[model samples]
Target chain A: MLDVRFSDVRLPSGPGVGYKPQHFNDILKNAFPVQWLEIHAENYMGDGGRPLAQLRHLSERFAISVHGVGLSIGGEGRLDPEHLARLKHLVGWLNPASFSEHLAWSTHDSHFYNDLLPLPYTDATLTRVADHIDAVQDAIGRRMLLENPSSYLAFEESTWSETDFLHELTRRTGCGLLLDVNNVFVSAINLGYSPQGYIDDYPLDMVGEIHLGGHDEDTDDHGAPLLIDSHGCEIVDPVWALLDYTLEKSGPKPLLVEWDTDVPDWQTLAAECTRAQAALAKVPA
Target chain B: MTTQSDFEGALLDANKPVPAGLSDGSGRPAGRRYWVYRNNVAVSLGDALGTGFPAISKLVGPQNFKNLAAIFLRQHPPKSPLMMHYGAEFPAFLEGFEPLKHLGYLGDVARIELAMRQSYHAADATAADPTQLQRLGEAELMTCRMTLAPAVHILRSAWPAASIWAFNMVPGSPKPQAKPEDTLITRPEFDPMPHVLPHGAADFLIALAKGATFEDALKVAQSNAADFDLGATLNLALGHGAISDILS
Candidate 1:
């Protein structure tokens, strides 16, 4: 089969929310400001069920973004063929407006840890990640977007900065970027860097989408502040401020507010979208 | 070189120290910062199991279940990336784990919950023509082969597993009696509903699932229970959308 190049499909530069099953009816009834919906690629992979049915119904009414939590694109081992095939099958049918995966590894030696594990941004690691992204884009016949992970600690072996690493990935594989601003905040605070400086260095033109979410505050061993990307609460003020700063630089992109844990009712989530829309409004795209 | 190899190992095992060369931005040893990754991995996988086996979690209490999940996850880390497909071995794990040995029925309850999840996700199917079975003569009916829906699942347990599940999950359900039960899980629509099978129905269903003719299946059920009510069992199956087709 001939490998198709990255898709020309695009999502509107408006607020979107991570699709949740509990909010299905509410979204269909009144999804104001939410121009698109993003779903975790792994959730809808079943052969046939309510999940697929709901997705099918929603896709007809809204532009869908297939955001992958798995795929372990930075793993040392080769990508799991079966998982890649499942992803391909979903993309084949869903034909979502966008597709994205993380810049981290969750699977190693057959055991999926069920959490996004970080990677050192060394030259060898960059090549491996680029290769995995290339394979994914080839398999699904579409350009993939890679999202940076929230960091708790940095590796001394990493020679490249996170932004430089992401820039090189897009340069190498022709993939886009999913700039998760909340992750930027979490990583900056945890690693003693400036979030705004990180955004300035990021290759924003290649970013297909942007993400905002919440974090939990804790302290490292030295009692320095550490933020865990919990995604359980409303987007905090500082993160929203960071989003405003990021928009000032990048203008409007397909912004998403992810509340995966302790998900609020439709009204609460929609309010977040309203705030995101206001942020996009500030930018003169 | 030692990056992923040692990193993943420490994520699963709490005792393992933070991998070499990892530190906070100030170059301090990673220390408690490494626990962030460890907590994410343990808490997320544990939460998945807790959601997967709500009845098991309820029976063992939340804290005990969390500890069990920690151990179970280490022993059987998900081979698949799909979170729903994780914890396939948990029911068996409960059956053999020495600490939970006294609660022998916990495994069976877990089985029912797993079956319900599977049934909920099983392929959609058209119900078999309900009138077709009634139209056939007794001899013809016995000779015909019935196709079961992909959503149909039978679990025969020595404990009243279905009853126990109902007591825990369903409000105002009766307390479980100490008796054997055979559970038939079916998805007539979107949600899976578990029905307590009458005596010997499991034999009949198991035989039918194995491609036995109606005559053979009925004989198996009747042999198991001399007074097996074939009509009631057939009504239950037909009404619940368990049968997908009738092949003569």
Candidate 2:
């Protein structure tokens, strides 16, 4: 019943970019074809400020999505009610077109880590994650898209493969997936699995949105290539190829281009978004 | 059955030698993966503090900031996942922090910055109608109770924190001469702007904040600063939209 599919939602044409104050003047002046803007929910959690003011202005002009980084949904304990209240407050204020959070946990024992940490894929883990997701959706009174995370290491105790875990989560919670193609490629390379196989097994029908971001390539202690989801540079060719393959299967979804660190100008990020749009357009929807 | 609480308990332990039972694919212990989780938590919280308090970070270099942030994070893991409001206790922490006591004014500067952030994020409410003050005759205006704006913050300090913060924030601005200063932060528009208040402003605002009538606040202000100007001070507050309502 909570199937908010991409086919139901029409994403704006052309590319979208992250909203930053440094590029405010440029954003206002340039008549560029930027369609949407994504903001970190935690940044605007306060009562009011320049950040909110800018977001208000941008929101009026474009489609906005609230991408959260600190829910810690996969943690072993109960969800933080205080954090949930703040998120609910932001959702009420922004009323964004879409909302998303990572499938990782970031807190333990009442201490917040503030990063999207990986969760093991097990029946026990799956049930806990599904319950957490259900709690979040219930609290906010809306369905949310859960993104796949880029992991640097794998846990030995994971009983289920990543694909099966995601499929089970969607099945149990009735939540949609925000498939990050770059993450699949990163995990596949690091854990020595076929990225294509993972994609083939992915619950494509449950995918509501897609994220494309850059990664860092570092060698492990064994000198083998290790990909970290740095989100700092341009989307590499392999990730793009993976994206192409995903679009072919899942059809065009609301794709996002994320760049957090050492961010370039608005135009540079827009160019990356344009690439995603072009790839999505080429897919037979 | 790994209960949500059980999974959370394991994830919170930063020094876990191995992942124990939580693993995906390659069969590495959950402990090694938790290390990545630990690093991300510390780094992100540290980065959030850095971003929220840029002036503080600029005063102390990135390396020192990160080191201090790690220590601070261990002591004060954020109460909320809302990272923007994460460093509310940082100023108090800096005051008692033994290593940074030599800086003397760093804590007060942090207080000033924190107040500015609070003002910025305070709830949105309309300013008290100036006409409400008009109905009260001149005598009443001088003696009637005034309600300060929820968004206004008054910070009294022994260091010229407002001036120091201003000089550092503005590109190429001259450094402030060392002197004790009281600061008033207000969000008339969207962003909180910090202003250096004359000596009596802090005492005067404190009285007003405490629900004292204008006359009582004036008396406190005069006692705090021998040459307090009640008219000018009231005018400054009114102009800045820092006074939300006047309760007769």
Best by TM-score: 1
Clashing pairs in 1: none
Q: Name model 1 segments beyond 4 Å from true.
A: A1-9
TM-scores vs. true structure, each candidate: 0.97, 0.90
Candidate 2 per-residue lDDT, tens place, B53-161, comes to 8888878777998888888887888866776678988888887989888878878888877777778778776777777876888788777888788789988777888
Candidate 2: chain B TM-score equals 0.88
Model 2 CA lDDT for position A38: 78
- Best candidate (score: lDDT): 1
Worst ten-residue run, lDDT, model 2 chain A?
Answer: A4-13
- DockQ values, each candidate: 0.81, 0.52
Question: For model 1, what fraction of the real interface contacts is kept?
Answer: 0.87
DockQ, computed on Cα atoms, for candidate 1: 0.81
Residue range B6-108, candidate 1, lDDT tens digits: 8887888888878888889778889889898899998899999998999898899999999999999989999999988888899999999998899999999
Each model's lDDT comes to 0.92, 0.78
